[model samples]
Target: MSLPLNEQTVLVTGAGRGLGAAIAAAFAREGASVAVNYRNSGKAAENLASCLGGKASAFGADVRDGEAVAQMVANVKVRLGAPTTIVHNALADFSFNGDARSKLDALTWDEIAAHMETGVKGALNLIQAAAPSMRERGFGRIVLIGTNLFQNPVVPYHDYTAAKAALLSLTRTAAAELGPFGITVNMVSGGLLRTTDASSATPEAVFDLIAGSTPLRRVTTPEEMADAVLFFASPWSRAVTGQNLIVDGGLVFN
Candidate 1:
């Protein structure tokens, strides 16, 4: 279906800045009431909410924490009605500069667990908290954010990539299970986005190499990726589920 988010309530986690912020704005622009969830970037969230006008508001929560996630959902429901769309974009603090020692032997279990906890556990908690309302209405959309790095395995972001891969699996499983309830779970995986906070530290040469290798001969913007996400959240995708849409400018052919 077309993007008619008017009056739809959407919660976007990690939406204080970067790709998350763009996603939130896109939903807002579509007439959706947006809950801009942030862990530490409260000001950024508020600012974005302002730009979205009255249809958007800022929320605080650590998605990895079950209690916090539940509370955030409850608050959003109370303030904006039952959220029909949920976007799991929250991730543990990760660096893209190849600064951390990501070698398997060099990393500790805690490091790996930390990353997976946010992606897997966070997704589970949000779904549990929001799915009931969706089932009651027999309609919902859940989009999980992933990375294209898993396809080529070039960047040795072992922990981050592993976590995202698990998230993709979770997305598929959730879609299968929630299908009868009219809730669709899908994933949008994109390669290094241009000019986001996460990619600001990436080497210019590295980004150039990726852009050159892409069939489109360019890197994608957060806004472009957000467009893909909006499609899943809109009514047009009611029949689509358990799918992964890579928005990496044709870098990986599925």
Candidate 2:
């Protein structure tokens, strides 16, 4: 019972590049109109929208700001119809350089707060803004981008991992509240992606180490993870909700 995405309008946050961009493209390929949301990468977002053509368009907003998120959703509705699918993939500015990360002793509450602002608070803002319309229509899909590091904790990225764990909790809680409205909230977690702006800072040795450790003997790609995200938004997953689907090629089985 797979659902076709033909008439869906999807809004992907932080879609200027990285996994977010890939997710937006995947939805477009499935014939869904896409709103590519970016906080700072305006040029890249616009270029991607142009490349996508059709109903795809670029939008700008800092997801941390509730007002900004509200305005962005409103604009998307006027331009591409209300988004029936929302992907909360926006990340706080971060580099996946384990060597440079602040260890537990040096980690500050401020650093943790930064990640929470984007990962947890940002998802909250988007869901609050979009849930009303979704409830009215009796249909919606909310997918939060997560990290496998929460389970593996290979490098102890304290701030980032903690934030994602909180987001996972929010996903389930949201599912319980929104299920009656025909909305499903779930998470797509991926391990060290081969290369994204965030992961580009990671050393080659790290990538090789993770690849060798995975059953697939390779690092996952943003495009590959995007495909798993599609399953949550499609008709195939209408009965599923609050599940965390890891897309890291067996890196950490949950």
Query: Which candidate number has the best TM-score?
Result: 2
Minimum summed lDDT over a 10-residue window in model 2 is located at 1-10
Pairs of colliding residues, candidate 2 = none
Q: Kindly list the per-residue Cα lDDT of model 1 for residues 52-110, writing each as its tens digit.
A: 99988999999888899899999999888888999999878876877654788787778
lDDT of 2 at 60: 98
TM-score of each: 0.97, 0.98
Query: Compared with the true structure, what per-residue lDDT tens digits does model 2 show for residues 12-97?
Result: 99999999999999999999999999999999999999999879999999999999999999999999999899999999999999
Give the number of the best model, judged by lDDT. Answer: 2
Off by over 4 Å in 2: 1-3
Clashes of each: 1, 0
Spell out the clash pairs found in candidate 1. Answer: 1-236
How does model 1 score by TM-score? Answer: 0.97
